[model samples]
Target: MPVPVGVIEQRDDGPLRRGPRAPAWRRGAAALCAGALPALAFPAPSWWWCAYVALVPWLLLAGSAPTRGRAALDGWLGGAGYMVAVHHWLFGSVHVFIVVLGGLLGLLWAPWGVLVRSLLGGADGPPGAGRSAAALAVVPSAWLLVEIVRSWQGLGGPWGVLGASQWQVVPALRLASVGGVWLVSLAVVAVNVAVALVIVSAASRLTATVALVLGAVATGSVWAWAPLPAESGAAPRIAVVQPGIVSRAPGSPQLRFARSEELTRQVADGRADLVVWGESSVTHSLATHPSLGRRLTALSRTLGADVLVNIDAPDTDARGRHGIFKRSTLVGPGGPTGVTYDKMRLVPLGEYVPARRLLGWVTSVGRAAGQDRVAGRRQVVMTVPRRDGGSLRVGPLICFESAFPDMSRNLANDGAQVLVVQSSTATFQDTWAPAQHASLGALRAAETGRPVVHATLTGVSAVFGPHGERVGRELPTARSASAVYEVPLAQGATLYDRFGDWAVYVAVAVVAAFCAWRGLRRTPGARGGLLRRPLSAPPVPPAHTVHGSPARPGR
Candidate 1:
């Protein structure tokens, strides 16, 4: 057997692993590479399988650290890489503050790296399969905890979650039904740990192989045996109107109206049961603006179907003159239907500035759009009038709102048979943002066990079945036109919809258990396996003779 490589721990300022360690710059670069490697698994490049091994380098670096502080630095730098790579699109909008966001967000992983070093740094851990298995389980669990915490909307929302990288992976998408994205994330992290274990324990390769095999088996089993969604009702014919219009700064009112009107008419010419226009397609509301409302009313009558459009307009209530509210309203053949859904979740910097009082100084970084948009209070499940007989229950979300999982989940739970995402990604059409935004429909569909229609303004308009399989050809980004699709309706809630975020709870439990285990190890008598630190020097032997006299030097 190969000699067991000893892990060195430097309690004092000394050489690491019996030698001078590499310079801090080299180590920092390694950490950054570890963090950024996973970005390839996301959109644009979209190397989906890369997520399974993306964390290996960073994890190995953290585990090799001679001290917890060093390990934390390693993890932080790695996290900074991930944050910067995943959200680089923010650079166009947030400007230099993208660096600030990455730096701040990267801090979330420092303690995580410290924990990895503390538990699996191999100081006290014996060279055996047990340690390998523990690493395989514990590393992913800890990562799940980090992903869950980082996903909190206040930080940045769940933009490029690890599991989301597997949007195209059928097995991974199936796992999402039972545990949400957290389950898939856990599986991916475990796979990475297994790969690391195999490399670290060349002498004891069987354990590592077992871990890798088990991960594959579990993933395959989920894909083969997981529940599939059942069709709940009749299919609805949906047509998306892409005006091929680009807006840099909301140029002109008449121009916007005419464009939306002409394009919608072209698509809605009695072709489908419902017609969709991208977010803010109708700059004014039918309720407030009569001229715009009259034209839509005539169009709806001519089409003999319901016309759905988004409106961003100011509303005056009893409280005071509040900011503009953006909502989607459905127009009936006769006139305006009161059925409407307001966007619940608002974009942080794009829609409104957060902490306007303290950090309001960021106006110099990006073009500051005056007046924030107000958010809606509750979920709205609109019963859209169909060309057939009974109406189809649909839950509509605006551009940025689709990113929030709860928005879709709440809609599904509230009797929404189909999920519709209306977006205008003209701002980042040329970039990866449009495709990334459109792909979220797959996850939402799998999670809620409902068909999802991602109808966008420019392009990348796609549809997914209840099980997240792509329904038809996805319209590419940066292009525009009218595309008609027959969206299938599915019934019955998945385990995720019924028991929401079970995977997150599992992650929390795993984290709590790991913390408790670490605490137990630090206790006075905790064995701590092979990494046990000597509390005091081994008892000094008395220099004595056999007859109780001082022993000689040879004795």
Candidate 2:
């Protein structure tokens, strides 16, 4: 007979075998899980496999650890692996900063390991149905908390969040309507837990498997049953211009400008109501350069569509401090609207470094030239008149600004019929950044119940309908391409749009309560009136202390 590695040794009198080796299948299972986790981060337009399998290794390792501490360590290792693999793209944008950022972000998973170990009872306890169900709730809840904490402004990069891995999974996406992205994240985690349980134990495997299937069915049913709002009959045909400038390297500015002009000219003759350019399409300010403005005016007239252009311009506020603004300018039809929306939510270091005065001397730490950029005061929804004489209100979000849910919601709530995100991902080209950035538009669409048209300078520029469905086609990143998409004016609003993050608040409270309950239960003397005072309280010190020691220390 084969010896079991993990099984405890038994004496001649005991019912169980002694010093047996752990089952070979269990160790093989764990190894398989560890190897499969890295790939979970990127799934082509279909990532449901990640939702079903990502947690298996953690589950298997948790089962192998004989003590709570060991289980915690195993979980932490899995978490670190998952985070580092998924966020590998961060290195491309901030290569030097990656080590510092990755380490700080990796800490977010440390507690997750501890929590999972405690919830599952050191992996050695009876793997009963009740325990399995509890695992489902606890694991997902832990993940949701980590995501919420990391998504905050300063803690970590929220890019490639686990929920985003399910971008193509329509059923999982329905959860976004209830609690933004966190709910979807929760559902994915829950499914993973259920799947892990079914794989580990045979006695209750059927039950666990059935439960997992039911959960998925429930998700799909929600998506199918959820009432989709009516879309307005008016459809605006918009052309997105991607003037692919592979390198934003210094000295290539003129080349980039020329390329932008060429692509704009190519699409100027299309049936576009409005020609939209990606962020930084115009490197110079149109207001300051009448020559550029005239050129844009001429393009609008020739194309017979209003040209919406984004320019990185210098603006001086009341204090006479010049700051760079990723400004969006509307030119065409009615002539120079002079209306511009400055980009908010700037990328740290990429756009402007934080604490620049102290860090500016570091050579790589200075703000992008033309002074530090100031964020826009509000979301700007510009009304662009269609060639058919009808006007379509477009909410303009610039580059990194599109990642924020509330920012997009504010625009839609303020009567933006279509959300337009003009972005330039040239700096972080060929990485997951473009694909990850593109995924945000779908969530934004789900949140506001509106279609979002994202036009990027490089690639992954695409359009999404009200229900977060992809429309027309997506352009590849880092290439010169133009796509015309007929986007519908969606009517009605999502529950999340109306209620905002209230559900998140409720979830936080619930998790907090559970943590508090667990903490209290773990305290000595809290259960069965077992008031076990420390064998004897430490001897009280004398009334007065003398110099380094108490007067009656020995007494």
Compare the candidates by TM-score and give the number of the best one: 1
**lDDT, residue 104, model 1:** 87
| Candidate 1 wrongly placed segments (more than 4 Å) | 1-15, 125-127, 246-253, 316-321, 525-531, 535-555
- Tens-place lDDT digits, model 1, residues 68-123: 78988988998899999898877877888888888888988998887666545635
- Quote model 2's TM-score: 0.82
Q: For model 1, what is the alpha-carbon lDDT of residue 141?
A: 81
Candidate 2 lDDT, 258-375, residue by residue in tens:
6766777787557789888888887776657778888778778888888888888776533455778788889985466777787767766666656778755433532233246776
TM-score, cand. 1 vs. native: 0.90
- Where is the poorest 10-residue window by lDDT in model 1? 7-16
Per-prediction TM-score: 0.90, 0.82
The alpha-carbon RMSD values of the candidates against the true structure, listed in the order shown, are: 5.4, 8.5
lDDT of 1 at 73: 93
Cα lDDT for residue 555, candidate 2: 62
